[model samples]
Target: MSNPSIIFIPGSYVLLPVYQPLFDAVSEAGYEIKGIHPPTVGLSSRQGRESPAPSMYDDAAVIAQAAEKLADQGKDVILMGHSYAGIPMSQSTKGLGKEERRAQGKPGGIVQLAFISCLVPAIGSSAASLLGRFPNEKRPLVSIDEDGWMLMEDPEATARMICQELPPKEGEAIVTGFAKHSAQSFGNQLTHAGYKDIPVSYLLCEEDLAGPPDFQREMIAMIAEASGRKVDVTSIKAGHCPNLTAKDETIEWVLNVVRKAEESRPTV
Candidate 1:
């Protein structure tokens, strides 16, 4: 079977194009690769936003829209998200499962849910809810005002922490590209628990300062404990932004998972 399409939902404060290297590599391998900048991130102004500002559900809707477009074309998808992206990406797959969609006479659906050093806040929980509960040194961008805007006093520190494994210049550029993300993204409760039915995999960044190895393990365990599913974990010695620091490795790992998911898919 051919490799399935892979859609990547990037983390907070990051532009989707930041994953260009990974996207190029994955696409060069003859697979469809796309990345989305969630609405919750990088909004120049929230003065025109909804009453409470964009939340995880808003982000999930964007992701689900992309997946639905591909699935409608009879293309299977491997939904992969990074860092804070996992929360919304999890909700994006509701009713988009192969079996579920097929029952509705749809041509395609999501095959797997993949993550790279991400947060999987349980249904009814928000990323803000998990703040300070886990031990992490590089927790720079946490609190936000009622305005729902979070600005980094020292974006340099965040760049160094999240993309420490990358080149010094590259890390600097990454920080420059960061925008003020919505605090409501952290506080809003996640509505869907898509992982309960979908197959899941995690690419753990062992040396991530922002999201420590221990925290990643706990997230994996949370999925296992809550869903009763063993999340396939592949650890990489990289920082939080593995797609940039360890670009080659990230591309290859993504290809492997997509291939596996495509191979195991039941024909509709």
Candidate 2:
């Protein structure tokens, strides 16, 4: 069997400049890994004024381009979008060419899509619209600090709010790098709607305060309805950045999806 290639897409505000930990985790399980580093508002950018909006389209382009490359190598690719990355990846895989689609082991040509605590947009919905539904009165549990560096506002409070299930050390690292994202990015509705026609699975972070559970349910239902197929769901008891704190377990669940996807492929 060929090694499964998975692409790690990071979530909003947080800096995943390096995906080696995730890469190592999946590789330890016998899978090859790569990451799509979309352009982001550097952590140094001033809050509100910085731009995370362009990164969405930028990331989608990265996903699409990466799929083409993997297909050329005859490797099966799985697109894993964490946090807000789901929006770009879900949009990117809609209408790929045969070779591009097959690289992800999607027999018809595209491999399956996975949403990692990432919001799945409604057919024409924007990320901002999804957040509006959540009450903003409470201060953010994680955010950027005064130096333009990202950090958790209150470590203990944040741990309780987002990663009560994770180890203290792992949770602390996540909060330490919790950068502030551009508010405008969420408001920009995805221009692509191909996700409705592609195979998708979603991983939910049960304790996430950023992309809350209620919203995840709403978004998942909407994606399922739009695709005319049920969206697969898996749960991880962490915050928005599970890939950072729950790497091993998350990769295990992802492998399960990959196996299922491989089994469902038709002999061509």
How big is the RMSD of model 2? 4.5
lDDT of 1 by residue, 94-209 (tens): 98987789889998889899999989988788887765585555466444556676666566677788888777777776677676677778888888888888889999999998
Name the best candidate (by lDDT).
1
Q: What is the C-alpha RMSD of each candidate to the true structure, in Å?
A: 2.8, 4.5
Q: Which candidate gets the maximum TM-score versus the true structure?
A: 1
Which lDDT tens digits does candidate 2 get at residues 126-187?
77677777666654554544433333457656655556667787666655555555444566
> Would you list the C-alpha lDDT of every candidate in the order shown?
0.82, 0.67
Evaluated against the true structure, the overall lDDT of model 2 is 0.67
What residue runs in model 2 are displaced by over 4 Å at the alpha carbon? 17-19, 41-55, 97-109, 141-160, 166-173, 178-180, 244-248
Q: What is the lDDT of residue 252 in candidate 1?
A: 82
